[model samples]
Target: MHRTDNRHAPGASHNPRASQTHSGGSDTGHQSPGHQGAGHQARSVEAHRESVRELLADLAGTGRTEQLPLREALGRGLAADITAPVDLPPFANSQMDGFAVRSTDIPDGGTDLRVVAPIPAGAVAAPLQPGTAAPIMTGAMIPPGADAVVPIEKAVPDSFPRPGSTASVRLPATENGMYVRTAGSDVRAGEPALAGGTNLGPGQLGLLAALGITQVTVHRNLKVLLATTGDEVVEPGSPLEPGKIYDANGTLLEAAMRQAGLEVLRAAISTDNPEELTAMLRKHAPAVDLIVTTGGVSKGAYEVVRQAAGGQDIEFLHVAMQPGGPQGIGKFDGVPFVGFPGNPVSCLVSFEMFLRPVLSALFGAPAPRPAIRARLAEPVESPAGKHQVRRGTVLPDGTVRLEGGPGSHLVHALANSNALIHLPAGTSALAAGAEVEVWTL
Candidate 1:
């Protein structure tokens, strides 16, 4: 399904892994996005996401495997290993419309024989008597005691060898196994057909159907606590103050979570209240798989989220990417908490570049498609020290053009963009027509 045509233009920077040194101060440290404390630099998006992925892999530690019927298997990650039920084509059948006869009889004058009862499909006839011929249909089981089939056109029609009719008949010469489909020919009964951990798509489902299975057990879906935090944001329909805006991050994040197939338990919007946020999390952390909060993890003074999650194992870190530099990851209570930047654009960008990919791997599905190379619509530049994921669109010739500025506050621009063009760290401006790589949403 397509989302509404809302997106943002991209901003820029270099990959974080470029150069470890930044000429910031005499007493030097890593040049992190000055998010939490000035001296504590943030990790690059790549570095941070790798750590997060490792955490997720640990969380997804090998689950119990199981078996399931094919009908209920759509989109499910295979739990139990599956083996083929039986050898395909359980019996040998004729491959041509012809007469069943001993090959020796066909070369002699007495090759003709009387036709007995009709051998249509589904009826089991007694074994063919020697020297007598039976008519066989395509896919019809070859009667036992018969040596081979002579095509219909090769012999006389109606009954058997007549008194006046010549007993001699020309036989069609062919190998013994010709026109025969042997039992267990296509597959072996005990062979593994589907392995564990494969996501069951239509083709996989069909295999189960062919095996006559009707049910399949899948792993439980990831349960998530979805929420947005900020005092400046108001719910829809409330009067807009000079500095207040409607809460887009909550709605947007929830929808994206659903798109990624995580079951979201909507946590209420929390103003910059540390105690309230902490208490709420304390109550629900035990039941959720992940606690996702947007906003307030930044270095700003009113970092309510940072305060509420205080004293826990959580550490708020800035990543190298612009607009989304502010991020927080720590264990809230017992469950893992992922703090996204307050800006609407930043939250979604962090998701696309980081969280979503981890979720996809855990669920045994393909990661979101990455952006492709394209020509530039115009010229642009970045602080050549971070991997910049910029919002852009494909032109008529498949080229990607910049969408907007690098400011984290530009929700509209990010909303209007369909893709992010990534530029490596330590490199600067690109003139029109320069090549770039992109990751499409």
Candidate 2:
């Protein structure tokens, strides 16, 4: 029997789940100064999943592909249905190197057939005449009147020789439909080969290629505009003043967005200013499908993104989630805008929990994995009314152990963890070996 362990080992080992998190989401939603933690309803996992599903529904469906190059089609969603033009296989073909024979010709001493034409794959073939054998290579078309194929290893070469080669087999047991692929065996004409919302992975692409499709209609890649803002933040390579730290969220999130197959980090600016952030968004929002901004979304007076969208439909919902609770979501200049807390870890977690789920539904990729039930290998404390997504590892023996301290803003810990074990709202603590749910990173 196989078991998964979630316990912390003495040293680092490969996590059993081998999972990647959704985009930037702090597993934790934080509290600003002078604010109180509101009592939060701990919704069931299914309820949270439904919330993500609804958000995707709110967005207008992505644009239809006018046309797309097959080379760039990986991970893109198909915009329209694709049907096969002709029957797959197109004709009867042998599945093995064998001799084609009438079903009645089988059984020792049943019928001694004379040799006729030979057929190889990629060569046109004629139907076999009664009592005559056609030498057939693997994938060679079976001639008419032949109902079965006898493996070459079982047939006598003297019985039916290759057209231009000495290779032959001894005639043996003949089985019906043995090593034969009939016309349209895999797919029929007029049947849907691919459909809208299908993401083109290797398997799907192969299926399309099998149907002879050189072009595909796929949804336009989601275009997103992003900005990082903070007076105390400096871009890398620039000298930093007192109390100012270099911006990491911008580059981190740009890489993350690129990883998710979105168009990001293309704009000219990577600096911080309320006016600049607002202008960048206002200018790009119309052209892009979504806008994301980090840093200035916090409650501080200098919160550029929040102030810019002050009168907009944006709502800063301090979701009960930890490390990523400070979030704003709504429309801006007719485009959907998402705001993430400034902290690097928070932004990462926000992307994982909220943005990625919605994106998965829209773009049709596999959704970020959800919390799986596991047993804790040690005891831990939690803040009441908050759902903490703490970094952890799941062992093959089924124990889950914390990877680092519970601080949600630690980027290194976030990177090392393979999962976020859920500490449900209002739960103060848990002892070792308690069953818990963990969200795979």
Candidate 3:
């Protein structure tokens, strides 16, 4: 693993079931004081990303492995190099349903040769006499003395003669090794088929199946503790009160984590009470690889996560980015903790920008989303000092049409969007047709 200046490895490896906290993080003993102050300084998006990467540089994966069947290995990372146990196409075979012949037997125009017994698939064949032709099916083993195959369509008198008849068939001149699949031509035994850290996709799995691999060793899924907070938030299946609404952040964040190949354990909604929040954290934090909570990091009186985490080493601060400015990051009880803003869209955006990249860097399985250049379909204004991430739809003509405004509460618009238009901190406005960076959602 590549080491950054600020990153520190988890001092010791812990078993998956161990509840003890592994020591990790920077050895510098201090971070900039601005990280804990009330909007003292606006931090760049890249700075926050570096902080995340520092935490993930050592926690790349759990370093555990499991054996899974080929069908279950889809999307999993290979644990070790896979070497071919047997040569592909273990024997020479015919490439067409034609006649197998010696290249020496063909005359200048054509020659009628005695037709011997036919060789169907899955059976051994008799050796060809010097002046005889043997009928062979596609994929059937080539006879010992035959060096080439003449397609049935190209045979003179162009069809197979009767089985019991003493008919001699004519074939045109052919070169040696024509239309024959040679043994070991694809992959030789003991050759490496795939390297470690490769993501198992359809093609990779197919190759393993073709090589007769029944089981594979893969890395274990990442274990995460997911929590949601807010007094006004209620679970989805419950009845809604006058001022409370169904909670969307929990389900949204859970789905995103799972889609990124994480094993998530979502806790019940943590209300505005600090004691309840702290209790939930202490109960679940030590047992998981990482802890993530939605809401309760912004500047509000009911910020339960920030208040409860005060005694711990967690820091609450603002990032110079739209939709997900108020954030919290640090270690709690020796486990990495991330606090996202409460709004539905804010929570989702934070995961995409920070957690997703960290996961990609760690496991190397789920690839990063593609970034493309697209023209703006209409005029749009951005804040002077913050990077704006706006939901949008990419038109067929390579233009982006933004959805709702920049407010973090626009969950409906977020659901309808398929792309995100990124306006850097220095960009204030863009006219129609201006090229912009678009990240597919």
- Would you estimate the TM-scores of all the predictions? 0.69, 0.78, 0.76
Q: Rank the candidates by lDDT, best first.
A: 3, 2, 1
lDDT of 2: 0.66
Q: Whose lDDT is greatest here?
A: 3
Q: What is the C-alpha RMSD of each candidate to the true structure, in Å?
A: 9.4, 8.3, 8.5
Model with the higher lDDT, candidate 1 or 3:
3
TM-score of 3: 0.76
Q: What is the lDDT of candidate 3?
A: 0.77
Looking at model 3, residue 64 earns an lDDT score of 74
lDDT of 2 by residue, 256-366 (tens): 787777887445433445567677777777788778887555444455666788678776545555666556667887677777777777677678777776676666653
After superposition, the stretches of candidate 3 with alpha carbons farther than 4 Å from their true spots are 1-50, 57-63, 94-96, 99-117, 124-135, 142-179, 237-239, 299-301, 367-387, 394-401, 421-441
lDDT (Cα, tens digit) per residue for candidate 1, span 1-441: 111111111112222212111100011122323322434444656677776676566556556334455655566666556788876566777777776665554453434465644455565655887666677777778788766777767665533343444343334554466677777676568888787656788988887776666776555567889777766678888898876678887788888888766778988878777898888888888889888888766555567777888799787665666556667776887687787776677677788778887766665543356658888888878655455667888777888878877655566777788888876655467888888887887
State the C-alpha lDDT per candidate.
0.65, 0.66, 0.77
- Candidate 3's displacement at residue 49, Å, is 4.1
Pairwise TM-score winner, candidates 1 and 2: 2
The local distance difference test score of model 1 is: 0.65
